[model samples]
Target: MNAWICNSSDGSLISFYLMGMPFLPKSLFLPVFFIFLILYLFVITGNSLILVAVVIDSNLLKPMYFFLTNLLVLDILFTTTTIPRMLSYFLLGDQILSFPACFLQMYLFHGLSCGEAFILVVMAYDRYEAICHPLHYTVRMTPQVNIKLAAGAWLAALLIPIPAVVQSSQMAFGTMTQVVNFFCDHLAVVQASCSDSTFQTFLGFCCAMTVSFLPLLLVVLSYAHILVSILKINSKEGRSKAFSICTSHLLVVGTYYTSIIVAYVAYRADLPVDFHIMGNVVFAILTPVANPLIYTLRNKDVKAVISKFMSHWSRGYP
Candidate 1:
């Protein structure tokens, strides 16, 4: 019932059928739907609480929390872009996406994923500045500079995927091409194309590598300086305070890269298609879920603010 096309633009059937997590059996869809629905709720609720706390509490109005606000926004958008659609597919069999819609999802997924990495790097740089150059930190990390840094990270990330998405859009596709992943992931879409995918594949790898390791490299360098500065501090308490400042960010960075590496290995290994799909799914959900947890549990200031807010709300204070 689906039409095939020699060219992407000429197709009468301009839709994609998403096979949301092909690993699971149909009978299990209900349970899986419930599970992911809970996660989606957690992602929203946890990140929203932190965002609200940062906004309302004058204590959190700093360069660090400002960057955290950007990361929280990205986490919310990133999961929203994929999880709700995934939930629909699980619960209602709403798997089919129109051509434009599919590409848009793919673009947003990759762009926001890249944005998170850049923001983490920015956060690391903020830590480096605060620790390594405490006296000059206020002057260097002014509001204008922080704004520019956040804007640049987001702009560069959002722009980087344009060429790849545009090229992928031009590739040949069959009628109702079946995307093997839950969402319109870049690699999954490319593999579904009828056109030769070698160039696209390579381009994707190059972009992924650059996005993954380059920011990672920057984060490492920043921490290297942070470590040296921490050691140079004379008092034990001072050293401990400096190290504690970075622990939350470090945990987040570790979790983000670990998920990516797992996903990359799963994709590259001689594994089943389901493994690849699940890998990407984990990559999609894991970081966002872990980010809010890491910040709240590990960062004292954020935790304190969130606790105070909760108590105030429980008291029914306006």
Candidate 2:
């Protein structure tokens, strides 16, 4: 019993040390680090401004904008959780994270990601109501209903990853391995486990399928129906306006889902590390940065609000 206890304690210490070590190549570090730093700054500033504008502009206070605000908030949380720490590893060379810290990062990262997926679904449904059931838009998408939907999305995201986290924490780490990726990704971390991970793999697969693929299918279906509805409208002006509203959403959703699917496929197929990294960079860095820009540039309401805000600031004494 005493020998067993000592071995267990030694194993814990080794796991702690492995979790804390930094792993990155010097040649590839600086460029990737700087690029992501710029992206992180842009994502935070852009999303924050969008959230503020949504709150201040009463005209923007509808179901669509409300859901958008939630999405902006989630994007901010998601990028901040992963990118800053990753940048620190490059800038300061402080690659070590405690087990708890790594787990925390993974939790927040996946939680918000999953939440954003559901939020996108909610947004699609909002658009559906507005386009298909125009008369019931107001009645169907009440403030209470919107709040519940947002809350449910968040709750589902948080709950879905609990099993994975628990299983991951319990896995034994036999001395020498380190996480190759910049962040503690679910699959990467699970692959390093010394215990039997069959159940963990299955659980993660289930979560990924439900959280990622199902929502993607819904998004595709929603856009398909939206397109059909737009085509039926007789007025050229009406069709043009409706298409414009959806264009931003389509671009953002397309970038997000495509990158995610590519990353998962590459990881599953054991592709080269560079390919996997590129996939993650697209999903993690580019998508969040692009989301605000896509909406602001393509959606007139956001552009108008931003222009008005900028004009107000420009004319001020500061």
Q: Pick the candidate with the highest lDDT.
A: 1
Counting only residues 3 or more apart in sequence or on different chains, how many pairs clash (N, Cα, C under 3 Å) in candidate 1? 0
**CA lDDT, every model vs. true structure:** 0.92, 0.77
CA deviation > 4 Å runs, candidate 2: 1-28, 175-177
What does candidate 2's lDDT look like per residue over 129-220, in tens digits? 88877788899999999999999999999998887887787777644346656777776667666666688878887887788989888988
Candidate 1, residue 186: lDDT:
89
Residue range 1-318, candidate 1, lDDT tens digits: 124553455535668988766668899999999999999999999999999999999999999999999999999999999999989998899988998888899999999999999999999999999999999999999999999999999999899999999999988887778878888998988888888889999999999999999999999999999998898999999999999999999999999999999899999999998898888988999999998999999999999999999999999986
Superposed by TM-score, candidate 2 places the C-alpha of residue 112 at a distance from the truth, in angstroms, of 1.1
- Cα TM-score per model: 0.97, 0.90
Residue pairs with backbone atoms closer than 3 Å in model 1 (clashes) = none
